[model samples]
Target chain A: MRNRLVVQLVDFDLAAEYRRLCELDGAVGAVVTFCGLVRDCEQQAPIDSLTLQHYPGMTEASLGDIVASADRRWPLHGITIIHRVGELLPRDQIVFVGVASGHRAAAFQAADYLMDYLKTRAMFWKNVAHGGERQWVDCKDSDRQAAHRWSQDPKRQ
Target chain B: MIKLLFFGRLGDATYAAPEVFEASVGLTAAGVRDALSSLYPALGRALFEPQVLVSVDRVIVDWQQPLLDGCELAFLPPVTGG
Candidate 1:
């Protein structure tokens, strides 16, 4: 199966990416995908848009490591992770993660694992625009907690 | 010489990335951080705040890690990506 990892300024097509993964291996029976979007409000404040920034070489390397980690833990056919940068309006797609495998469990866990790692470790930063003001978003404790679980999972390790 | 990079809000405050620094032999990442903090105290305060992450040559590392000559050092603030 084909594995795709990308960071670009353009939007990602989730259906096409998932279809590509599912079609890559004929034996694949399950495909799990996650798409993160920019919401209109955060913390009860209205937001106009979000600006995402990331390191060029380092961002790619970090994402590769994350995918490799997921690959080692699961028997998977294919995986795709596409993240967008630059300014994005509300309701816009921010990231896409897809996994294909013979069973639903493997695909589901791998997709979750990939998204967890991508949240804190992917070297991306976001700035939110609200009420004519803009500010960089802070890391959430919940996100860190989510990523931390994999570290403690013996099977995942 | 070591190449230093600042990303996200750190870049905004520092106003530059890929800045160069003269590093002596046996310097550690922590040492270089202190030197940078003092050199640009404002950036130092903002960048080294709790939860900041550092990398050596693109791989995440502890501050105590030794710095190699010609290596690239990057400072990253808390990430908020999905």
Candidate 2:
């Protein structure tokens, strides 16, 4: 039942987050974490910076819902999701998803599900600055497909 | 009053500041879109584009969704965050 959901303009500490998840329960045997980083290049062009925009109230609510859904689907000891907003340079951490469970299978799958849903369901947008031009990033078809796969067989894993 | 929010590209295309208007009875989400569209044609095209989502009070709803006083209506482009 130890769950942490945060949306902030500042960065998060992965080590501290991992330790928190580790101490969630004595039964926790596996911890899975995923961190998304800003890339240095988009397509073939070098990028200057990336700006993340999000609906303040809606973004937090959406993250809460995604975490709740993951909790229902798995027997997790803890879950942590932190997403950063505002301007960020290349290689900056953009998102972090961590799940702790009694077993590796549950922990791994829950973390994966959390990320897939976050990419599509969360109300956050990314805009990239490249060559002095800025543009909003578009949702990828592959990401849609990845999220769709989870719905296809909910009972699996 | 109904508060309208535009995010991402929509915010850039239109006003970044939240727009507020007096909420009249029988007003629907589509009505607001039409009202804004007539005033901003370029934004109107973007609003009509595929994948643009409309949310009322933080929840996604159809265009026919009715508005309530003091509700927050947000127009969101397809989200790309990880």
Candidate 3:
């Protein structure tokens, strides 16, 4: 019935989030979704706690831009992009972006597109300070590989 | 001159971002990186090359752009999203 884009930085609430995404998809004949949560371990590093950073104004703009990109490409009934910021403990919800569309294909594509751009383009950054001494996690090459797959022209093998 | 900011571990790694910098009037984010490299010789090893991410006014800049006055520039490591 409607289209929406939601982005936020809270302690992260799961049950409420499921409700929010659920509420937005009344028109969708089919809805496919995903949720990303914080794990106890990261890249062989013990992440006792995490603090997410973002450029406030820029963060919202980046979200809007991604939403716009999706709008430009496909027709979807609803969209939800909620990413957590601030100090987060292990097992906390790191981020989630769910899309609802008329069919399975659009929903899946929208969700994948959102995640790809979020990794490459979002202004948000993560800092993992271990219990003993804090360490800043580096952006991994794998993320680049994942994001690169969405480029306009994929390298022909 | 370009004024840059820092955050999180990226800030800690650079001993925190410089409050201000006297940079060339019009330069790209690449120029900002070079300026920071020259200014903070201590970070030459960790910050040089094309690995650093630069932001203008909090938005990451795709290199090959010009810097503006009072623009807040940022040097970020490859991002692990927040």
Estimate, for each residue in A17-75, the C-alpha lDDT of model 1 and write its tens digit.
97798798789999999999999998888999999999888899889899988989999
Backbone atom clashes (below 3 Å) for every candidate: 0, 0, 0
C-alpha root-mean-square deviation, candidate 3: 3.5
Which residue segments of model 3 deviate by more than 4 Å?
A1-7, A22-26, A152-157, B13-16, B23-31, B62-66
Candidate 2's C-alpha runs over 4 A off are A154-157, B13-18
Better of 2 and 3 by TM-score: 2
Tens digits of per-residue lDDT for model 3, A119-145: 877777787777666666676777778
TM-score of each prediction: 0.90, 0.94, 0.81
Candidate 2 lDDT, B1-82, residue by residue in tens: 9988888899984443448967999999889888878878788888888799899988999999999999999998989888
Report the first chain's TM-score for all candidates: 0.95, 0.97, 0.84
- Greater-lDDT candidate between 1 and 3: 1
Q: Candidate 1 — which pairs collide?
A: none
Worst 10 residues of 2 chain A by lDDT: A148-157
Q: After superposing candidate 1 on the true structure, give the runs of residues whose Cα lies further than 4 Å from its correct spot.
A: A153-157, B14-18
Q: Please tell me what DockQ candidate 2 reaches.
A: 0.87
| Candidate 1: TM-score, chain B only | 0.87
Order of candidate numbers by lDDT, starting with the best: 2, 1, 3
